[model samples]
Target: MGTKFTFYEFFAGAGMARAGLSDGWECLFANDSDELKQLSYADNWAGEDVDPRDVALVKASDLDGMADMGWASFPCQDLSQAGPKLGMGKAGSDALTRSGALWPFLDIIRDLATEGRHPILLALENVVGLLSSNGGADFHAICSTLSDIGYRFGAIVADASYFVPQSRPRVFIVALRREVPVPGALRGEFPVNPWHSKILLRARASLPDTDAANWVWWDPGAPPAKRLKELHDLLDLSDDADWNSDEQTERFVGMMTNSHLARLAEAQTAGRPMIGSLYFRMRPDSNGKNVQRAEIAFGETLGCLRTPKGGASRPRIITVDGDRVRTRLVTMREAASLMGLEENFNLPPTYHEAFKLIGDGVVPAVVRFLAERLLEPLASHGRAYAEAAAIQKASA
Candidate 1:
């Protein structure tokens, strides 16, 4: 495809973001340091021009050309609500923490600006914890950098459940050059609706006046319709034979609490097909000691997929259809569907490897939504915006 638009995918695990931006957009460069992820990425898109170096080692001169858009789904292990909450004190330092990975990505953008090739659009995706990390200082730093570098941006908290069968809520910091044309319809005069939560508003209020003034309450319109496929819709045929055995399924059911057992009993009496996602997690008991608990969704949708913990930490699918009840761990193919990946996109052969790739990706459909609503419309204006940014910077 001739380059009508282009993007650079940073922290590009398996190139899932590239897949979303595939139509009408060409990837100018892609980079990731994880060896296995690099292999999968290369396998999908011929590895000829992909950058395999760590983000810290990459120089701006290494990039192919200025891109219309840039996407960075940085590591969230240090910023997740349930994570270490270590924040960004060590970001950009020699420290080897996953959260610190954000600094290197920013460095690439900052360096590119020195060469007068800053991408017109930028989207950074991570967990909602980014909004509150280190008492909002982490997010403030991100916003400050965007404004300092000649862009106006906004943050949106959108959940994957709105478009897929999984519940994954993430924050996307969408930025555009000051010169790009943003339709009035796309800019909300005030924050509103499913996109802006109370937490996000609080975070925005904490920003310094200079940085906050450049923030836009961007509206990407409505998310796609609620999932067309329910949890059971993606299941393989019951006869395919990968399900857990009778004894194993019995043991898993035994881990359920009385209330959960009652809910199952009600479903059993109703004599209808039902499916639920099951997670084995540790919760504090009445005595304040942590104990393993099996939790299932109240709705038919699956729980959020997460980086797997090897043995017992993955969420499994449990289906009950009248006299027939079956239990099985979610398969690699199903995980792809849950993440809005194309059917049979090249996931790794092993269970954990494939799960990790999908679990830590930006949903293709979600990216497509942002690209179509904003990035695509702004692509043609990228060169114009870049020139204007350069002129303004030079005059300063």
Candidate 2:
């Protein structure tokens, strides 16, 4: 075994996973299709290892080396709540077509298998919606398929709130090649811990019993996270900064329903200073009319940042302190901080592009937490794989 663990990253947008893992691990290769993200990634990494192309077009032969781990933060749009519910394997369905982007990743693994080159560990990240997508059938198929390919899968649902001020919950899957077993007996249900959320519990219950046998429900032996800074801490702009104009603020306020305005007024009237974050959601009103309602969270963590496809994508900040009320769009730096990116991390000059990069990327601190816990088990069996590979080469 070498002194350091290494990994290859797919869907490596803005290198957020890399930012998390960079401290303790080496990134051997990376791939992403978005050119703007590639620009941001290049600004930070500046290496030849980044392959800026669609994953489907990258041939197996292109992956010419081996690493200790493989990380894929696959696209979640096809499997998320806001997207169509077409299951992963449905024929001629757009959902299947889009989610099938995972096939190239599987193909790379298969290629490594053909060459007797297998990484001891693999990590997959996606939205929590994946667990219930297509009536939990898609999640089932993913576990079954990985098992078929000689991997034992373990999954946990983690939220970025533990590491940052955003409430982004995501499903993380860690897979080990069948040859390597974790220290303890693999169980389908682990004793509940601080990491156990209702969403995770429901997702666990939905897995097929047969597949559960191969499932390692890992318990991160850590206490619940302590509360960090509040939503107000994420606001980096000065009071005199150029933000929403008075007319624009009035226009946005007019777009909200009476109930939302009432909530804002109540918060503004509160004796204690309160900070609120706003995001628009399409919800049904009392008369069964689907209206765009502006939702606000006061003096709490901001909502999850998302790609700016619609009104829900951009989160607005509202601060009310001692009869003073202010509102403005969240800056790129603030979004980066919410994702646990470093202060010196490079960001695109363009606001929309930077926001998209931050929105689409994973929380580095969350990735680092998983990486630290996973390294020991992964390293313990590393020698065995090396020996097996050497023996096969000698025989050949």
Which candidate has the highest TM-score of all? Answer: 1
- For every model shown, what is its TM-score relative to the native structure? 0.91, 0.87
lDDT of 2 by residue, 1-396 (tens): 446777888998889998888656778778988888777788898644479888867766777567888899988778777667554554223444566567678767867777867677789998888787877777877787677677888777888887788888888888888776565623335645555567667766777787776777776667345745555566665767657776776666776777778877898778877767877788887899998766677756777888777545677887666556667888788888888888899988977778878777899888877766664455456656567878999999
Score candidate 1 by TM-score against the native: 0.91
Question: In model 2, what are the clashing residue pairs, if there are any?
Answer: none
Worst 10 residues of 1 by lDDT: 88-97
Tens-digit per-residue lDDT, 262-315, candidate 1: 877776777677788777878787799888877665465688888886677776
lDDT of 1: 0.82
lDDT score, candidate 1, position 344 = 51
Top lDDT hit: 1
96 Cα displacement, candidate 2 (Å): 4.0
Tell me how candidate 2 scores on lDDT: 0.75
